[model samples]
Target: MAIVKLSATERRRASAFFTCLILALCAWIAITLSNSYDYQVKEVLVFKNSPQKRAFHPLQSDTVTATVKGNGWQMLFSKMNEQNRIIKVDLSKLDSEAYVVVSTQLNAINAEKAVDNEIIAIAPDTLYFDFTNRSDRKVPVQLVKSVNYQQQFTQSGNIVIKPAYVRIIGPSNVIDKIKFWRTDQLTLKNINEDVNTEVNLQAPDEGNVSIYPKTVQVSIPVDEFTEKTIELPVKLVGNVDFYNVKVFPQKVKVTFTTSLNRYADIDEEFFEAQADLNLWRAYGYSSLPVKVTRLPDYCKIVNIEPHNIDFIVKK
Candidate 1:
C-alpha cells in the first residue's frame, strides 16, 4: 500500500461526511423505536379467587405467551421487566365451567403490568383444569436444619416451634397423603448462643394445596456444657423371687455432661441407677449390669463407675 497524505480542508470534509452518516443512523433508530408495534412476552400464570367448592389442577404449563401492543422503547423495557411478571387469572367461573379464558381477564392482567404495554392476547387462550373434591387437614411442621456449633458449645435444650402445625387445604386425594409439612432450611454457622428466629415453610409442591401462616417461629436453646458427677444409690430391679439381694458398692458416681446454667439443678435426685438381678438367674452370671435409667432432660451420661456389681442372694 502507498501512503497518501490529504490536505487539511479535505480531512475536515471527510470527517464531516462520517459524522453526518452517524447522525443519520441514530435518527433512524430513534424514529424506528418511537413507533408502536406488537411484541410477545412470556408470563407466569397464577389463578386467584379460586372456587371454594372444588379443587383444581391445571392441565397445562403455568407459563403463557402474551401479545403486547406498545412502542419499541416500551417493548425494550417491558421485556426487561418480563422476567418477574406474573399474570393472575380469575378462577371464579370454574365453579360451573371446566375451562377458563385468559383473555377475558386481559384488562385485569394489564393493570398489573407496565402501563405502556397493553396485553392484547394470550396463547393457549383457554386453560383447562382437573377438578376434585376439596378437603382440608392439619399437619405438623417439621423443621429442617443445618447448624454448626462452636467447640464445647451446642444446643442444650429442646427446640421449640411456634404454631407447630399448619392447616393445608387442597384436593382431597392429594392432601390426605401428606403427613407433615417441612419448613425452609434453618442454617447457622459457629453458633454459641440460643437462636430465636422465624423460618418460612417450604412452598407446597402441589399448586392446589395452600398452607396457612407460611412462617413459623423457631427457638433453639443453646449453651456451653461441662461435665458433672454425683453419687447415687443403685436400686435393685427384676427380683422375681422377692429375695433380699445385697449389692457390693451400694453407691456409684454418675458422670454426665450438662449445660452450665442447669448444672446445679441436676443432682442425685434427678438421676436413678438400677441393677437387674435377672442376669444371675437367667444366665448364671455372677455380676449384675448397672444402668442409669433416668436422667434429667438434655443431659448425657458420660461414665458410670463400676459398670457391674457383685451380688449376694439371701433366702
Candidate 2:
C-alpha cells in the first residue's frame, strides 16, 4: 500500500483557505452578538383602579419599570425616543377583583434586522382592579337670573315650581361639587293671562355630574292694569237724631287700576266710604256720621277725589 502526498504549494494554499473560513465565521458571530445585544427599556404600563367608573385618566408618574430585551443599538434608540418605551393596557373590560395579563413589544427600532426575540412580561401575571357603583343625590334649586315686568305691570303672585329640586347621581367626588341645576330662561312678557309651562334644567358646564330630573314645570301669573275713576254713593246706617246738618258732596268717587280680565267686574258699587257717627258725636254734630255702601269685592281703591268734606250744622 502507498499514500499520495500533496505538494508544498498545494498544502499552503489549503491552509490559507481554512484560515480565511475561520476568520469569516468569527466575524459573523461577533456581528450577530452585537446586533442582538442592542435594546432598551421603553415603558411599563400599570393598570391601576380608577376612583371613577367608566372613566380613564393619564397616569402622571413617569416611573415605569419594564424588562425589555432587544439588540443593543435598538435599545439605545428607544432611550432617545421616549414613545418607543410606552406600554398600553385596555381598560374597557376592567372589573372588580379581576386582573389582566399585558404583553408588550418593542417599537420604532431603526435597525434593519428584524426583532426575533423581543418581549416583556408583567410580574404577577395580571393587574387587578376593583369597580364600584356611583352614589346619587338631590340638590336644591338655584336661581341664576331674574325677570322684571314692564312699567304699570307687576308680578301679582308668587312663582310656583312643581318639583323644586333635582336628582343627581355619579361618582362621590363629582357628586359632592354639584350644587343645583339652573334654568336659562324664565320670562314674563306680555302675559295678560296666567302662564303654565315646562322649563328644562341646565347642568353645570364643567363637571362629571349627571342629573336625573332634568326638567320642571313652572307657573306664573301676569296681570294687565288700567286706572279708572268711579263714584261711590253714601248710605245712612243706623238712625240719626233730627238736626240741621249739611253734608257736602254727599257722594265720593274712587279710582283704581286692575287686570283687564278682571276689569269687566269692576264698577262704582265696589267703592266704600264711611265716616263714623260716634266720632262726630264728640264734635256736637248730630248728622255727621256718613257711611258709603255698595262696594265691589274684587276691587281696590287707588285714590279718592274729595276724600273728605266738611259738614255744616244749624239747629
Query: For candidate 1, lDDT tens digit of each residue in 56-98?
Result: 9999999988888889898878756856578889999999999
lDDT of each structure?
Answer: 0.90, 0.57
Candidate 1 ranges beyond 4 A from true positions: 77-79, 232-252, 268-297, 307-315
Q: Model 2, 135-199: lDDT tens per residue?
A: 67788765443556566664445667768888876656666777766775775554445668877
Clashing pairs in 1: none
Q: Each model's TM-score, in the order given?
A: 0.85, 0.33
Error (Å) of candidate 1 at residue 213 is 0.6
Each prediction's number of clashing residue pairs: 0, 13
Clashes of 1: 0
By summed lDDT, the worst window of 10 consecutive residues in model 2 runs over: 104-113
Best by TM-score: 1
